[model samples]
Target: MTKRLQLADIGSALIVLFCLVPFYWMIVSALRHPADQFATTPFPLPVSFQNLAAAFAERNGFGRALLNSLIVAGTTTLLTLAIGITTAYVIARVEFRFKNVVLAIIVATSMFPGVTLLIPLLKLFVGLDWINTYQALVLPSLSFGLPLTVFNLTAFFKQLPSELEDAAQVDGCSQWQAFRAVILPLAMPGVFTSGIITFIAAWNEFIIALSLTNDQKMRTAPVITALFTGQYKFDQPFGTQMAAGVAVTVPLVIGALLFQRRIVDGLTAGALK
Candidate 1:
């Protein structure tokens, strides 16, 4: 006999459907023919590529924005992981003075709203003439992103058996070499989780990008998408706007889908071993 669906199952299905409605609508609106773009049909019929083409058009600058976002997010993710993993490992493994106090302080800073840093950072960058530079974006993101990475990976590292590192050291490996070869590889799940989260956080950011960059070429994908709405050059810009949204969202969506299993593994790390 087939298992019957329970109320909880039905509720979950409803919630998932509700969440997907906007993405579905976005895809449909993006693919709709210009003449019938306003139609509310569930799926786009007689679809057209004009809107997609428009999104990547040189005039739109959304394509360039995508590249800028990729660079910023990629650099931020790598930096956060490199610094965060070592910091987290030290906190987790090595005993030091004010250890809890330092960890607490580090994590507490992440709680402060990023908006609070906006004016201060903008002013500092202007003084240094760093506006519109990749470092301006990546550095601030690191300031916020690094703490969470440290907090998460610290907990993950703590749960891992220290005896594993002991075994590696017993084999003539230096302390650094043991961590490099043994602990870090096993900690992939936590690292992967932190990397993806940091990347998405950096990628979706718009306010900082908008405020920091006056040049259209220096802006991010979301900022460029917002530009599409403000331009009077296109009347009834829904199709083009949705197309921009798709272009901006699809890559992140693909990344999440590809690494979903790893994400699950990260969340459940140390459960079995």
Candidate 2:
């Protein structure tokens, strides 16, 4: 048993190292001077401050783009979670005709490639005159991400004891009151997990934001960062691009760290009971 445990530990360590190797390389390359990036021995420590400065300097309006990404992602996460939690409670705890069919349709729809529907979606948004605006960026993300959020929250809500709702009802609470006061508080971990996932999805969403918005000032960080490369000479400098990548990744890292405890609890809630 001890030998087996040792092997498991070794395997886990190898997996962790493998996962970190790409991040290590990105940090290393990002820190290197562009001239030395492809050098024979390319190992170098990250020049943290210098790279951050360069990234901000060369990427015109990158700061604004970063702000746009944050606003869009934050709005999507909050709205998605709010709608998903309420709807999931109904789906999981309440009996209604065609519930399974509704869920099946949602799951099936999610499997469709997003790119295939872009033309029609763009036209719809264009008809609504939402182009080149924050609404264009956030509304589409919410539409895409909401289904998964509802699915995850439904599963989690089903695992919760119905006794809590009963107790609240016994204490003269309405269904909405019980839900808002009792169930929602208890299900916070699941809600936070869903929000984190939604935020990451919106943050990384490039195609929709890129397609719908043409104004440079209205661009998200991912879209603006992509214009770095040029045919003969790069429009944005290499070090700056690396720095921008790092910048884009930092908020996601922070969000994951903040909600990590909730994520674990949300995943393990069923197992515990």
Candidate 3:
């Protein structure tokens, strides 16, 4: 048993290390002096803040891009969760005509390649004169996020005991109140997990943001990072790009660390009961 546990631990460690390698390299490169940005050293020597400074330089419009990402992604996450939770709860707990068909359609929507929606969405949003607006970014993201959110949250809601809802209703709570009060709180882990996925997907989304928003002020971080250029036209600005990468990733890391406890507790709280 001890041997098996050790092997499992080692496997987990290796997987984590593999995932963190690029992140470590990005940080090291971001901290490196522009002159030594290409050095093969494992550690950054003569560290400089130039890359970090360049990342937020006026020409890059990256700071604004960061705000754009926050607005768009945050809006997308909230809207996705609100609609998804309700939709998932109904699908999971209620009996309705063609319920299976509805579930199938939701899954099928997610499976559709997002790229396929590009031209049609662009034309639709253009007709609405919504180009370069938050809605332009958000609505398309919802189309993709809702299906994943609904499917996952539906499964999570199913696993939760229906007796809880029944008990809530018996106590005179309306169906909506029962769901909002009892079930939602208990499903925090699944909600958080799905929200994180939605946020990251919307945040990292590039092609759609690029294709939809023509203005730099409306562009997302990933798009702005791609637009990063050096002091000279010929320069690659690799260090600055690394710095931007670190800047973009740090918030997500911090957020995960902060919420990881809640997620773990939610998962274990059920088993304990």
Candidate 4:
């Protein structure tokens, strides 16, 4: 048993190292002076913030792009949770005709390719004159985010015992009151998990962002990062790109680290049921 445990520990360490090496290299590249960026050294000898600075410089407008991402992702998470939670609760706790069919349909939407809906969405947004606006970003993001949120929350709501809700009703609470005061609080782990997943999806989404917005000012971080140009003629500014990657990655990393336990609990909440 001890020998097996040691082998497992070694294997896990190796896998973790394999996954982290690229991220470490990206940080090294972002911090290295441009002259030494391509060097074979594992660590930068003379570190510099120039690459990070350049990526966020006024000329690049990555700062504005980052803000745009935050707005879109944050708003999408909120809206998805709001609508999805109610819909999930109804599906989980209520008995109605074709309820299983409704759930199957909701889950099915998530499997459709985003690209398939791009043209119709673009046309709809154009008709609404939402082009180059934040709504253009937020609305389409909901299409993708809502289904997952509903599915996860539905599963979580099902796992919660109904006795607590019944007790709330016995105490003079209405159904909505019970949901808001009792069930919602207890299902916070699933909520956090769904919110984080939705936020990350919106934050990292590039194709829809690119297709919807024409103005650079309205562009999100992922789109701006893809279109980043070098200072010198014909150069790609690999260092600056890496810096932008790190900047885009930091929030997600922090969120995951802080809420990892909740995320796991949420994902596993309805698995046994």
Residue pairs of candidate 4 with colliding backbone atoms: none
Pick by TM-score: which candidate is best? 4
Q: Give me the overall lDDT of model 2.
A: 0.81
Best by lDDT: 4
* Residue 28 CA displacement from its true place in model 3, Å: 0.8
- Which wins on TM-score, candidate 1 or candidate 4? 4
Off by over 4 Å in 4: none
Q: Write the per-residue lDDT of candidate 4 for residues 20-72, one digit (tens) a residue.
A: 89999999999999888899988888989999999999988899999999999
lDDT of 2 at 102: 91
Per-residue error for 124 in candidate 4, Å, reads: 2.2
Instruction: Flag clash pairs in model 3.
Output: none
Tens-digit lDDT track of model 3 for 1-273: 999999999999999999999999999999999999889999998888999999999989999999999999999999999999999999999999999999999989888687899999999999999999999999989977899888878888888899998999999999889988999988988888788878989998988999999899999999999888778768899999999999999998888888888656544444442
Q: What lDDT score is found at residue 78 in candidate 3?
A: 99
User: What TM-score, to 2 decimals, does candidate 2 have?
Assistant: 0.89
Instruction: List candidate 2 segments past 4 Å from native.
Output: 40-42, 45-50, 229-236, 270-273
For model 1, residues 97-159, the per-residue Cα lDDT tens digits are: 999999999999888777888899999999999998999889888877899889888889999
Q: Per-candidate TM vs. native?
A: 0.93, 0.89, 0.91, 0.95
Clashes of 1: 0
- Per-candidate RMSD, Å: 2.2, 2.5, 2.4, 1.4
Q: Residue 234 CA error for candidate 4 (Å)?
A: 2.6
